[model samples]
Target: MGKPTGFLEYKREAPQKKDPFERTKNWQEFQLFMPEDKLRQQGARCMDCAIPFCQAGTTMAGSGEIGCPVYNLIPEWNDLVYRGKWREALDRLHKTNNFPEFTGRVCPAPCEGSCTVALNGDPVTIKSIEYHIVERGFQEGWIQPEPPKTRTGKHVAVVGSGPAGLAAAAQLNKAGHTVTVFERDDRIGGLLTYGIPDVKLANEVVERRVQLLEAEGITFKTEVEIGVDITAEELETSFDAVILATGATKPREVQAPGKELNGIHYAMDFLTANTKSLLNSQLADGEFISAKGKHVIVIGGGDTGADCITTSIRHGAASVIQFDINKQKGAMRSGDNVWPLYPIIHTVEDAHKEAMAVYGKDPRSYMLQTKAFFGNQDGQVTGLQTVEVTTELKNGQKIRTEIPGTERTWKADLILLAIGFTGPEQELLQQLGIETTSRTTVKAPYGKYTTSKPGIFAAGDNRRGQSLVVWAIHEGREAARECDRYLMGSTRLP
Candidate 1:
């Protein structure tokens, strides 16, 4: 898109990050700005493929996400950045993504995974270029509140202040509709403000975008929950349309012996409290579950597990280890992990780097499954028992087996469960008589987003279960478009 031989001339150089040991001491973001020249060089790596799978927005045959869920104009922006047109690149970015800042920080970069350049070596630094584009836009004062010229006089009540709700609110407001977002938490940015660790998606980043949304005339109400503070009937009578963006927060609990130990905590509970306490009084509140001076063991593996390890290290844990039930992936992609599909390979995350710097080794124990938890006489957790597992393919399905005589016990005072989530909470769904799938997520088709009753819609994690922030934003925008159509019999949202 930029230069024909750019991919061949330049090697991939990821955006610079703060030193692991130093950054872990504080909760500030670890990602540093890249110089514009370096960014342009990376942008030039975007080879003009006959068909760029990076923006396909569809899942190929893979074990992971294949492309960008938001379907970002990746090549266009890449070319723009290569040409040093920062403002035009930003405009292209904002056309598809409501919040590039969030995705750039937190998304796993499936776009990079499916890049045409990635077919051989590394992909273009699309994520960093996107981040720099938006941040530069903010720095140059190109991004300001552009409130709609006229109001539709239609009211939209959005539940949850997470990415999905915020996207819906923003888009609806752009269409000149009055939108009010209701959040049960004390603050806005549901998962953005709480679920993620600050070192990854800093709270300030979220607050800044939320403030811009407020300036654009979207109303946000905190500590106000639907089905508790206000009834579903009351909401239907008050607002013209309702959108439940309440995320899939019901965490999957570990089923093991002695599970009721005092030190066991859900990942979100620990992360939320840590961020809250950090923001409230720089953690002086002592309101969060601390890993200080304690041996910590995190169950499950993924972003959440890594987050737990990083947080534990920051809290000055004596020692930390993570348990993963699956076998470790290879360094390179397997044959089945074909091109355009997300490569299933092992990679080190920021948490692993920090933990390695602190513990002298990787904090992960693959193929180990937690068997039981052990509690002391005081009902506080002392440790946990785990066993080695062997996995094999059987009739196109994976079969797991416990290895005999491979059971081991590890000492730990704090155990954090980062397994995953089941689905959204059921209070509002039940109250509103909305049907859910077998997965317990809200029953709404992907594009339509209509619930059992008209004027009531569902989107984001509540409808799609646990997914990426970009996907949540996509659904939020789509749902708002549908809601607009329902209200006005026509729509212009994209």
Candidate 2:
């Protein structure tokens, strides 16, 4: 709140992005940094509302009424940034979020959705300001490793190096406990390193944070899986506390005719392979599922679906199309979509924009459901059959009905499933002897994060199903606080 009238005077100015066609030429990040003067102006647009629902971080109305799950000190940081207190702004940012850079880049920013200013006009540039604060902190050398002065002599084992596991390890180490993170992959940063493409989140950004965690005394052991490389019994005996953040790697699939076609693959498998290959040899290793010169059909219309389209276009796919089971949303919010809730409106994503620039049209087809797949004698997928459907929102539930005589075949050589995930894989959970919910997530209550087995805790997608990265960070921090109390009969973490 630098100036009381700043919200009205200074209109929202988003950071410039590289041309879609130009950015697709390579895998480099497309977003360019905003000027410092403009960032300060954007921060001043924060209206000092009495009750900032921006940080409510709760669900309401069985609706999408959610906000910043990490509950960052939004107003404080906004004010600090407006007043040019760059270092102080970074401090307020880190007070709530362990990894602002990741959230700043990838988070949907429910904080903006729930901002009071959005009731009339645009919300403050909360996400951009947060991103710049941490980036500036690193550039100005304000961020550095500060190892705990004393050791508690307790050991913690975190299985997974994703956002949640890393957050838990960071907090546990801050409390003077020895923390060791185990990842099945050769490199650390589970989903961050592989699930997400480097175009959206560069590899170096993750590596920078990992290096800092190492300097702060947290240990990361890659290529060592708990259920395979190391026994769960060994983990139980070796550490005072154990955290399961392996995430929901189980990909949701469609059970249609000819589903076993060779070209059909899970979105994560495609993204992971592409990222790994890119890092290893800029995709020269031919280790990834290439969309080059092939017709790609992606199912599911969520963030992952968007990513699949973007990645395919970057790979020089001949034709790319996305199928969405739900009907297309409107540009404006519906009557049911009230304030403080995430506005249910349609907006073109960067991925769609890129697709349009390359394909000369948006690649998304709405209200379409898969029926079956068609494959050649060689077992390679050739196309898919789908039926047009109508959707209705009855009593806040989506009811989809397939229309008769609307089934049609669409040609495709490659299909990527981006629907979502069922829950965490059961192998590690079973080996650890921990109880899971009916949905397959570990049976850890929200806020309490306690599993069936004593001394065992779970968080992130493993505990909450597939969700935003910010929520994973929130649960990880809270779990660490609870784990610390369990280890020492009391806790100093916040």
Q: Candidate 2, which segments miss by more than 4 Å at Cα?
A: 392-398
Q: For model 2, how does the per-residue alpha-carbon lDDT over 1-494 read when each residue is reduced to its tens digit?
A: 56888898899988899998889899998888999899889988988778998988888856785678888889889888889999999999999999999998999999999998899999988888888999999999999998999999999999999999999999999999999999999999998999888999998999999999999999999999898988999999999999989899999879799989899999999999999999999999999999999999999999998889888998999999999998889988888788888888888998999999999999999989999999999999999999999998898778989999999999999999999999999988888889988888899999989999999999999999999888889999999999999999999899
Each model's TM-score? 0.98, 0.98
TM-score, structure 1 vs. true: 0.98
Candidate 1, residues 15-122, lDDT tens digits: the string is 889999998888889889998899999989888677888988887442557778888999999999999999999999999999999999998888898998888899
Task: State how far residue 91 of model 1 sits from its true place (Å).
Answer: 0.3
Model 1 RMSD in Å is: 1.3
